[model samples]
Target chain A: MSDMPSCQFESRPRRIVIGSSGVQTDFCSTCSVRPNSICSVIEPGDISRLSEVAVEAIVPPGRGFIEEGAPATDFFNVTSGTVKLFKALPDGRRQITGFAAPGHFLGLAVSDSYAFGAEAVDTVRVCRFSREKMTELLDDFPKLERRLLEEASNELVAAQNQMLLLGRKTARERVASFLLDQMQTGLLPGQDGNGGRLHLPMTRGDIADYLGLTIETVSRTLSWMRAQGMIEVGKGYAITIVSIAKLEVLAAGNG
Target chain B: MSDMPSCQFESRPRRIVIGSSGVQTDFCSTCSVRPNSICSVIEPGDISRLSEVAVEAIVPPGRGFIEEGAPATDFFNVTSGTVKLFKALPDGRRQITGFAAPGHFLGLAVSDSYAFGAEAVDTVRVCRFSREKMTELLDDFPKLERRLLEEASNELVAAQNQMLLLGRKTARERVASFLLDQMQTGLLPGQDGNGGRLHLPMTRGDIADYLGLTIETVSRTLSWMRAQGMIEVGKGYAITIVSIAKLEVLAAGNG
Candidate 1:
């Protein structure tokens, strides 16, 4: 399987790379890139201030950026890689609250700390904006402030959708929905416009826990999908999407 | 039968007064009130600013504050009323998204429009903060901004919990959990802290849609609960909770 992307998805904005010395950062000129953060909404003046205060860093697989209840260090935006944001129960169970794809901002808080923790699901590269700098930028750039508000609102909607899924759908339906989402989100590769096949990142166990089902059930469903030829599986957890239309039927329970 | 609350719940907040063409609404400060809406996070100074910019109004029974895609109005805090926030499919099926209790804010947004439609299940009163005033207040008051973030986060968690219910739990368990939540949230009056008993607000039909079950199934379960002496219901929705502990067990799937 190819670890590198076949073609660079242009929608993903390139990181504004500041040299390791972090000195003399380009705090000037009109940057046309639609930033994935509250930075996007602020004017040039606010961007300069944020650029001055913000630090950029890289996070590798299986590492965490934020922990629940900890005073937030910096608000984050993923330039690359996947970040799993989750909340923990004292009893050791973990519910993945969300996954931050590229262009997604990780932490944008109004308080001292965060209720959800952020962990790197894969090798991640990020740019950090301290709360103070971000706040200053927000004040200086009213548009940026509104964007943050918008992001929060959108987050609420996404959360509500997740709630509907967790609170209402059957396990099979959840798995089906998850599979279809992977296809649409470009998380799956190898589809040549026919939506034929793609690779899966987490294991069956992860899928089961995420959907609140046992691994055995997840295995059974995959086997069923394979038998129906709605899917064909290859080595290393790769699945060919033979018929998304049929899978949609299965997901909606008509099947 | 009485709309007036009989018992004053300690540690639980009563609804705030909606409209007072006055200077500041310091309901959160100095008052023995627990915070509900994002406004609860604001200090006295900011709350005063918020009050200056907001208007209070009462909503009659069965009326909605915002419809889907309507131009943004004043963001709201539900001072009094039972609100059912729901999303309806084109096919006319409705999913009860959330129930807004007292002290919780409704219609607060970072966008120009509301994504879901909100209607008062009963006569409702709300503190209305116009879009212009709200943006100004959020910009000026960082503490309030933080609270808004937390509120959004809390809403996010609630959505995730719903996902678990909708995607995994059995029909019986969903209804059971819904009942448990109502009791805990005071949507229905809880057990007298002695013998456990609860009154339900919406009917079995409502419960069926919310839990993704049929009305007949909901009715069957209610009958089952009665047979086990778990509850007793009389005319006019006089539902008596017999065993909170046992109900919790049932909700957890022990039943």
Candidate 2:
């Protein structure tokens, strides 16, 4: 692990070099997830103001960038790859709260310490902004605050849905709901609109933590779905939805 | 239920009049929860802008003010009493997401429909703001947007804590944690500086739903706590914390 903070870049500068005007503009200008991020609220002419404060960092797979209960000093905007956010008990039991895809923002706690920890599911790149700089940006760009409110509202809705899932949904229902949610978010790999193929990024243990179930239960539920012709458990991280209708029924708690 | 929306007043107008300038100013100026609410961001001189848009309504006990999946038309600021927010499954299962106390804000969702339902746990008073009027307020007062962001961040942290509780904590730990949280929030009624007495507004079923436990489990756990001399069950809807230190140990997962 790197000795620097989670938002600091590792000892690799060849992938994306910073500090040059041309490259700085190129980084934010042609970014894939910029339009869906909080940066979209900034006007085209004022894009430099965003690039001026954002320090791009690259995090390796399984590397934790944000530690739960640590001082929250930076805000992160994921540019690429997936990140898992989680909270752990003192006894070492952990609960995976949610996964952050590209365009997700992290470190929005009102308290001085982070409420959860974030780790990269794969090699991830994020634009790190110091709290002071982020506040300055919000001050300069009045629309940014409204944009953040919208972001927070959307997350709140998602959180409520997750609460329902964790509290009331059965093991089978939870897995089915998670699969459908991933498909709706377009997180599936090689999906051709109608294709049911999925390349899940997290492991069964991670799924168990998120769904408040055991890994054995998750595995058993998937096998049961496969037997019912609802899905196909492909090798490794691959899974195919054989029947969306059937999976929807299970996800809705009808099964 | 009144024919009007969830935020509309019943037949009573004698408690607080709205049309007159004197009453309007008095309503916002003397509001007990205003200082701790989102309206605090508005300047004292410009307080009239708020009074102009707000319409106070009284919700009776057990009455639902916000229906899940209904049109998201108004935002609410609880001025008095407790409210239970929840989401229900198709099979009639329900999960109480959280309880809103005085000064808590509701109805912040990006969707056109409310993500959760809210019912008055006691006789509740709330100030209602139409979505359009709220947009106008946000435009006129930029600080309001920041304040709402802060509110959302605080709620997000609470949601994360609830998630950890539901997914990982034992029944004993969950009840202990809930009691401690209530004490820390100072939500107890007639609470002196040293008193641990709590006048719980919600019923045992509400507590069960919130903690993701069945009523039997919640009851059994409370009995166990009482046996351990950690708490005292008084008459209807009353509980006294006999040993805060013991509850702290249980809440921290040491029990």
Candidate 3:
């Protein structure tokens, strides 16, 4: 287990998000989502200012946040739950384009309008900051600006990886990649690596939409994995990876 | 030409690299590269400091400027020519991930290292800035940080769109979309009121790599476009859009 680097974080970058109930504690400090989040990079001063300028908003499941051609309002950093960015074809076919976690930022646009729609996959919490306030922050802190730019570059890299998935990978390969990616992202809490178990967020349909396949295909692939004894699935999106070695092989396009 | 929006302007942002002698100009007013890039949301004061810290370097085609896992040293905004960012798979299958243009930033990463290598697609000129300088600039300039963040979001959008192409669209549709993306991105700069016309950088092989197809497929698709009178190919990489209406129709994944 130690052979695999701990990906325990990448979910909750920032701990502050106001729910209807009240302010949440600093869940980011020891939560599983801290390792790769920008929230970890924010200094005390930055966090203070961010808290001052940001608003916590609840995103109900299936609710729309940003849609294609909509004006860019506030940029969002998810604090909890999952979100999917997707596009619809002229024929009404839709593609789940990206999956955003708690630490990930969403709906940022250099142009005035967004080019994609951001929709919540589950009941989610997010930190929203005004574009203007963010601009002021950039002028005051060059390191933050650099960090944001670097973040953008990372986003592009991930996008390119997605392109490879869409362009080159087979359906089975895509499914394997998705499962591995979800596990490696480790946005959720609990499930200490007792026997290589993992958690999932979206359903079969969402996976199908993201991977450009049908729900049936997703089901078939999962069934195939089960038959191969590579994984054991339980209720509530729980998965025990019986063999990550084989899954990694599939993600490498060997499937 | 009068009808086409001219993106050219006097006094580009700034240069990141120190050496610019051999750097060819991409436009009359714009140097080979801009120092500040689109993320100039940072303050003029910070910009000046970063200008002192950045290093400029030039590389000919087929050479790499940044490797995938090396500590992030420099970031760049492309001034002239093309820079391709790509990820190398475990088995060494190169995924032509992205192509950077004039005024576009390069070597941007959220982490200390780049996920892909930056390779020159042409005799490229670049403005280089240290990541530390970028950090300072971003920390000081929230606007710049916001801009960079938004730009990254755009790249993510582009990647998702590319995913739709690779996963859902046919080879012909992929070619059409690539042509549209190239032309719209200003990679092909000279078109008149009649329609948008521009040059295509990289060969069919490059396009195939980017689009997740074989060179044979790319060439066949181009031939098919010509036979259908959708576009006219000229000397070098010049291409005239014989039918924008048909092109957009195909580009929307309708054809």
Candidate 4:
């Protein structure tokens, strides 16, 4: 259940607060994903209180932060990098349920055991909290609970969307939908001064796993899309959407 | 989008409290699904507080309780009967995401609009609450907030499981899994002196929609299972599981 054996970790003590006055350190105040995370729901003066219970940790590329079927102990908020959440069958077949970005919360479990495994797609930084401390924090801060409910509801919506995509969409539609979704999620990180471009941190195999397709099928679809001038594939995983409207049409299964 | 127009309702004063002291009336006190619902999180003496904000309503067979793209305003807890939740494409193609039973909560929209439509599969009883009042209730009781979080987490887990089913399972596997899930959800009811027998409230077309299959495929799969001595079908939708273990093996995709 644990993927830690395949990972190398660098551990360091993260300073939260200097004293018991709930004074936040510069690190907590300057966190890049602060505005997008559940921490945004905290009262201005309560960041230090939250920081006191959070430990900032780093996960190297391909390292797991949470393991499937393991005892659920901690909650994680991704501060940087991408992590794929997956569930594997006993025989080792895998289904990638979701890919979490910075500001996304992971490690939610229905029971005491984690339902999925999560591994960093790249070097990732996360704020980790023990389950007990998180519970106490939720009890102390009603706004945080409300924010959590909203996030959970959003995740449920996304999961339902994924169900529709998996169940109904054709291969071409699936690929188009995935590209559009990646664009919306900021996974594209368009540095070409054009927002239509995408930079995939995850590999083709990851895409295949996430989309329930074979690697060869995924590659074929991308090539076909490129041939049709719908998208341009750069070196490696870089992709630029050449025709957004056409891609949308394809994603809607009308093309 | 409201669906009340299609439903025939017999409205009456749902007396929640007898006096001014928030004493619960027999209606709320004897509600069968209370212990399994959000009301269970309320304090022992707070039933009247909740009941005051809740309106008990019945939805007749084939009537929708919640419609997709509707402005979100109310929350619902099913007290009896089955409700199917689904999303439809612009072209009228539909995919059912889930079915709600007694104690299941519906109408937790991610944004201001409902993402899916919900309809009664049979005569359904539900307790409806205005979103504003529910928010107030959650703020008044932290336990209820905690309980909602748990339910949302559970729903997320179920959604992930359905993702795996939709993305990876074959048609036969899908049918088998659906049957097992119905058994677990008490959809079978099993009041015919046989716990292994199932009474389906939803039609085969509903099953097809929920399983992402054609109605013919669902029927064919069921017939195949019957021929294999894995099940027995009576009049209409009654089904008796002849070998639950074998069915489970099929559900696991090993058959």
Candidate 5:
């Protein structure tokens, strides 16, 4: 067995504190999702140093956290709420690359400018760190660097998976795949109470952008799936899979 | 500025040597694309250590270097030739995620199994390292870790760009985008000589897979581009952009 340091991160609630910016901030100590984020890989002794450098901010729905083509100055970790990352063509056509949840990191880039725009699907909270300070922290903490690398790897994998979804899958397959993915990530409310019940934080247009389909096609496919007794939709946002096997078959493009 | 230790790796011609396993190996000292790869971020003193753990292998055309769902045992650095990375649905529908050129790294994953399959587009040479050994080396080399992180970030950007192509762009726009991308990467032949002349290393099927188009659609679009005086094709694999501005307009979805 390698002697590499490892941490098992889980989320819990805590209290908030004030920041250097004179605002009431949720310090690292109070971050319920710390263990579920890159911050979890750091030694407990380093938590104070991390909190000292982090700035907490809240974003209202429809507000952009990061704009595409802007200079990338900071890295963000979503502490709560959902954010959709997208790239827009000059003609206003948008393609959502991925969605960021509580544990997901945002704004890691290879170049000087952000490649995509990040917007809040709902009211969102994020911990922000300047790139310069974050690099220093990474240099000081090897475990943190490793954890960030792992996160980057995860992002790459997810991107490639989305490529498959966009490039090959049919509309029904895409929607089914998206539901299964959300279910696996526990993005659905009362997830444990149901088999494959899911709560979508994003809108139908958001889903259309994500799945590379028109909103009408997305709705039509969902309706068809419902007619086939494969899923049940509630309140236009909640989804219940009545037949997971069939859904999986469709997702695999074998149905 | 951070005082991170960095290396100036340069590839040179050298004879193969026998390793501890009694197998003839292409040592790191002779790698032709070392300076162009992530290895350049390591110190010169660490090159020998890296070579000691690496096994150089040659892959023939049509052979897979990495298979989806297989145990993720090794990481690869392409020293020569092009490789296509892809994911396949159960019914054999394939989505080509990205193509790897010389100096590109392959096989980084978030799970124990590879998320995609990598196949040689031509006769390919690669430097292979066990994942365990590479992780240890990463722990020992901070600059290398930073380099890997940067590569992963770059990959995410590329993947997102591809997502935009697959999701939002039309067939002509997709082909134009592909050409512009290759031109930007200097993957085109006579990149500095004449116009945007390209040498396609992969087949029409590969291009079709990458662009999420039927082979017929790809061929028809190429013909359309030619008729529009936007591009010129020669001897099948050679392409020259006759009108880059128009191509860019098409790529932006405004044509």
Candidate 6:
């Protein structure tokens, strides 16, 4: 991990006192992302067991939590905000493999070292679990293992799609596909949807890295899309899909 | 699946009769790749259970057995030969995601349809199991599920590395990295190794697709490496590594 900032444990109390209903709530119980995360497979009765091992931490914007090639001791589940997962070469060239959103799981490698580094794209909150504790949980809950396999399978599919994009897709097609995908992720549960409006957290450089394009190319493409009336670029990290049909045509490689 | 030959069942008997000792051997028990594959996690006593659901089939060279966007009905374990997994654009631009060698597991998607297509690179043998049957095995054998998770994790790591290669590496670096990876895979158990000599199963076109380069570029890079005394391009698909140190330097982006 870098010296930027570590994932510091939240200073709030682990147990919260409910107002007047006399109801007791634990960390995992009130977590908004649990329903969409791997924790959803755990029964309500066993949620306390999960809470016992999980430590909620907050990572400030642009802070790196996981370093590539470092010891794989911990796993993370994003509870809020976006995280960018990437692999860098010795020459300092980088490739952003994926942007992990809330409810996304990190550190799924079988190797003893991490294959990629993870940094907060925005102010992020995550639940951390040690490898030994995670193994114990998997042994105790078969459903959790199955759920993880499902998650890994889904990630593998996404990786394949990314390979196709990086290897074959045109710059315009890649940008359009990325916008559409962001829209889809924004529509997921626990996310605030503002119709076609999107609040992108990463910079244009990050977008270029993810799409295997230069920053100038990304900027030019966005300008072209705006001029074509396919999208409306708004102030500071905001973009609106003006014409979904037109973007879809470009994303499908027909533009 | 395409109009090419399907993975047809082998004509050999399921049970082999040993001479003199009258010992009975099932298909999985005699499988050459079983010891290194996910099947290794299954108890010896449960071998018959696996054999009951597995159907051995042969796929001829260049046969497409798994089609992109087709219903994913079964999972396969390669026992011999190599298979290329790929995704194609609507305009017919293809990206060979990764090559699956012996002991590799395939069709791990959580979706109802395959995310990519798979084709045999040479005469290949595989053990096929229906998704329902595989699920039953996983339910009955927790270790099997754990093993599958490990396989998926390893594959995820490989996919990330491939994304890095495709998105960031130069053409020469990409080819160098590919040669080193092939050498490592060749060194694995059940694969034939003749010093540093490699009998590449796929064509130059496939290599170009996998490395995100054109056929001309791939050829030019190989010739450059050969002239630099880093490798020796032999007849047909043969290529011998002349100096691993040189290739490693190039692969690490220092050449």
Evaluated with lDDT, which candidate comes out highest? 6
Regions of candidate 1 where Cα sits further than 4 Å from its true position: A1-34, A42-59, A63-74, A87-94, A107-114, A128-144, A170-173, A187-199, A219-234, A240-255, B1-76, B89-94, B108-114, B126-150, B164-200, B205-255
Which digits, one per residue and each the tens of the lDDT, describe model 2 over residues A49-146? 88778888888887888999889999999999889899888877788899998999998888988999998887888888999999999999998988
Which portions of model 4 miss their true places by more than 4 Å?
A: A1-26, A187-195, B1-26, B187-195
Which 10 consecutive residues of model 5 chain B have the lowest summed lDDT?
A: B1-10
Collision pairs in model 6:
none
Each model's DockQ score: 0.26, 0.81, 0.42, 0.60, 0.69, 0.85
lDDT of 2: 0.85
Q: Itemize residue pairs with steric clashes in candidate 2.
A: none
How much is the lDDT of residue A62 in candidate 5?
70
Docking class of 2: high
**Could you tell me every candidate's TM-score relative to the true structure?**
0.67, 0.93, 0.78, 0.90, 0.89, 0.92
Candidate 3 lDDT, A133-178, residue by residue in tens: 8767666666655656656676776777787777667777888888
Mind giving the per-residue lDDT tens digits that candidate 6 earns over A193-226?
3337778899998999899988999999999999
Looking at model 3, residue A109 earns an lDDT score of: 62
Of 1 and 5, the candidate ahead on DockQ is 5
Model 2 lDDT tens row, B1-255 = 123236334533324546556643446877889999999998888887887888888888887889998899999999999999998888878899999999999999888889999988889988989999998998989989999999999999899889998988999999999998888554465665544888788888889999999989999999999999999988898899888888888888875
- On the 0 to 100 scale, the lDDT of residue B148 in model 2 is 95
TM-score of chain B of each: 0.80, 0.91, 0.81, 0.90, 0.87, 0.90
Clashing pairs in 5: none
What is the overall TM-score of model 2 with all chains considered together?
0.93
